[model samples]
Target: MRYLPIDNQLFVQNRQRLAPLLKSKSLVVVNANDIMPTNADGTMVFRQNNDLFYLTGVDQEETRLVLFPEHPDPKFREVLFLRETSELIEIWEGHKLTKAEAEQVTGIPQKQIYWTHQFEQIFGQMVFEAEFIYLNTNEHTRAGVEVQTRDARYIDAFRQKYPLHHLERLAPLMHYLRAIKQPQELPLIQTAIDITDKMFRRLLGFIKPGVWEYEIEAEMMHEFLRNRSRGAAYTPIIASGANACVLHYIDNSQQCQDGDVILLDIGAEYANYNADMTRSIPVNGRFTARQRAVYDAVLRVMKEATQMLRPGNLWDEYHREVGKVMESELIGLGLLDRTEVANQDPDAPLYKKYFMHGTSHFLGLDVHDVGNKYRRMEPGMVFTVEPGIYIREEKLGIRLENNVLITESGNIDLMANIPLEADEIEEMMN
Candidate 1:
């Protein structure tokens, strides 16, 4: 792990909160993410499962966590199963976590920590004793599961072995627990945002006409790596010119012309927490009058949208209110007229023509972190306020984004120190 070690008390507190939520005589199992394969002999870098990491702070592969809080045997109440290391394996893959180290990192007693080889015997005994099984899987609403994960495979096998046990989805409980940020998690998230701030500031000086989009992306990667980030939270989108109008454009093949605007939707991940940010800047270090108009409109909408991220705000209602603000901005930008907006269908707003996509999404472990969209906003919930105007005909796209934390008083902008004003960006670049 490139990031520094986190205090294990966070994980200990997380487990303590989760244990009481499970059914009586229940056993919860969470598996680490598989080291994904690319080709015959190649594999992608391994990433720990968020739930497992949140619960145990264990960041290695082939690891499992078993929580049987109601077990008669106190030693088995909270167990950590790790892949046993050997001379050959250590030589090939470097050092894996030792038993004592795992115990220290996870706050579990050494007696409760076991090797992967002993998992079946121990888990089998616990399964027989428990009436309910809580299994973990990727249940994010936007998840597209093309490949089967390790946890998915385990779910299949566990069902076949213990069909009589009542199986429950652990995702709901996990999502509920993860939605509200713990006080300790704020520092980690703020660290990630600060890293992103550094990268964005660096790009202000690096971006110029005649530079390729991929080159700008390289600069971002360099900055993130030097600051202990695990590269981008997602694929870094460095779209220039008309490409910015395409929401997910990542080709990054075109050279930025003098009059073009580059849309950079990038972030840095630290300690498994993610920061999602988007900033659009001019290729020539200064926005043209027309570009400034669209940019300012997006910025206005972004500021107003951020203010609506207070506690008790409903996700759906908050978005609807933002849409009204965006509508007025689009009309001011001459993209939509009052008559057109008035005649537009209630189901499909006319503002979407210029301003598409949601104004905000939950930001945390995953880029688009999980939370109940229907639930009212609560203090400690973090969201990304990104508002944009994509004018394909004009070959211009402008977006301004910042991470905001909902508070009792209002919302606090995490990216408050980052430059957002047109003059500030231009001055930095100059």
Candidate 2:
């Protein structure tokens, strides 16, 4: 791992929070994500399963975590099964975690080491003893279907082997528990935001008239890798001019024009936690008068929406209120007509014309971090208050985003130091 070692206490606390949610005499199992295949014997880089990492802090592939909290044997209560490294395997690939090393990486003592091949026999024996099985699957509603995960394969085998055991979904419990941020997770995310800040600051100098969008993407990646971040949280969207109007635009192939505005939706990931940030700036280091007006409108909406991220508020309800705030901004921008809003569909509001997509989502382990969207906001839950106005016809789109953590009194912006105000971004660019 390029990132620094994390304290095992975070994982220990996470496990404690998860164990009580399981059924009595239940066994919970989690597996690492599969190394996705490309054509012709090639594979993509491995990413650890978020839930497994949240519990064990083990980032390697072919790893397994078994939590049988009600077990009589203390060693069997929390066990980690690691891929045994051989001399030949080490020569073919690189160093895999050694037994003692896994112990150091994860604070699960030395005795808990079990080989990957021995998983079936061990799990079968353990499942017989437990009454319920907590199976982990990706229940993220927004999850894309481009690739199948290792957990999907395991779920197939699991049902065939233990059909009698009551199966429990781990998603709901994980969604609820992982929603709350730990003190340790915050530093890693803040570190990621700091790295992202450096990348964006360096970007001001890199971006200019006639520069290719891919070049800006390259510059951001160079800065991210230097700061120990694995490039971007999502594909860097370096869209310039009308290209910026297309949400999720990532084909950074166009040349930025002198007076055009470029929207950068980028962030850095550190130690698995992610920071999401989006900033819109002019290609020539200063915004046009009209550009500044649209920019200010979006920034003001973001600022006002962020102030609403407090305890006891429903996320859906908050966004609805944010919609009203955005409606006024859209009116100020002259994008929404008063007549249209009066007769507009309540289910599909007038703001959706200029401002589509949700204002915020939980941000942490994933760019769109896992949280109970239906539940009310609570202290420790983090969200990104992003508001944008995409006037495709005018070839202008302005989105300003920041990471906010819900506090007891209110919410704190993690990216508060990073420039957001039109004047501040302009000052930095100049």
Candidate 3:
């Protein structure tokens, strides 16, 4: 891990929260994400599974966590399995965690920690006693999963071997638990946001007419690495000019034109927690009349939408309210005909012509963190308030986003210190 070691108490508390939520006599199992392959004799960097990390604070490969809360034997109640380090493995991949180190990092007893090679034998001793076996898989609503995960393969084998154990989906329970941010988790996210803030301020001075988009991307990566961040939470969109209109444009190969506005949809990942932010700025450090107009409208809508992130608000209602706010702004921007908008089908709002995506989503470990959309907003839940206006005809797009934390008194803007106003950004750039 590039980041400093986190206090294991957070993971300990997370398991405490999960225990009461599981079925009686349940055995929950979680596996680390596979190190993806690039090509022959190559592999991509490994990212620890967010759910597993949330529960164990273990950030390594070939790891498994087994929680048998109601097991008769105390040692079998909770166990952690790790890949034992060999002389060759140590020479090639550096030192893996020792049994004592795993105990210190995860708050799990050293006696209960064992090597991965011993997993089947240990798990077999507890399997028949479990009334339910909760196995995990990638269940994020937006996840486009094609390749089979380690958990998926295990699920197949578990079913074939046991043939009678009642199986359950741990994803739903994990989603419910991971959605709300623990107190300690917030600081890590704020650190990522602070790093992003620093990077954005630096980019203000670096951006110019001739600078290519990839150069900007490289600078962002550099800033993230310098500040102990693993890298971007997701692929960055450094779209300039009309490219900004493409919601997910990541080609980043264009030259920033003098008059163009660069729509930066970026985030930094620190300690596996993420910060999502979007800021649109002029390449030449000054917005044009039309650019400022659209920018102000989007900013207005973002402000109005953020206030709705209070506790007890329904997700569907919140989006609907944001849509209404965006509607008035579109009319003010002269992009939508008032009469046409007023009569547009209720199912299809005309404001979507310019603002296509959802105004906000849960933000945490994953850029789009796991959460039940239908559930009401509550304290400890974090969201990103982003609104944009894409004018393809004028070749202009403007978006502004800030992370927010919902609290009992009200919601607080995590990015409030970061520049949002047109004049503020311009002054900083100059």
What digit string (tens of lDDT, one per residue) describes model 3 on residues 302-370?
999998999999999999999998999889989999999889999999998899999999999888999
Q: Using Cα atoms with residue i matched to residue i, what is each candidate's TM-score against the true structure?
A: 0.99, 0.98, 0.99
Give the C-alpha lDDT of model 2: 0.90
Model 1 clashing residue pairs (backbone): none
| Top-down lDDT ranking | 3, 1, 2
Give the runs in model 3 whose Cα sits over 4 Å from its true position.
none
Worst 10 residues of 2 by lDDT: 144-153
Candidate 1 per-residue lDDT, tens place, 177-244, comes to 89989998889999999999999999999999999999998999999999999899889889998999
Candidate 2: list runs displaced more than 4 Å: none
Expressed as tens digits, the lDDT of each residue in 1-430 for candidate 2 is: 8999999889888999898888899999899988888999999988899999999889999999999999888878888899998999899998999888888877888788798998987776677889988888888889876666788788888888778888889889999998999999999999999999999999987888999999999999999999999778888888999998899999999999999999999999888889899999999989999999999899889989999999999988999999999999898888889788878898999899889999999988988888888898999999998899999899999898999999999989999998888887778778
Q: What stretches of model 1 exceed 4 Å from their correct place?
A: none
Candidate 3 residue 338 Cα shift, in angstroms, is: 0.9
How close to the true structure is residue 273 of candidate 3, measured as C-alpha lDDT?
Answer: 91
- Evaluate model 1: give its TM-score: 0.99
Per-residue lDDT for 332 in model 2? 84
Error of 1 at 284 (Å): 0.7
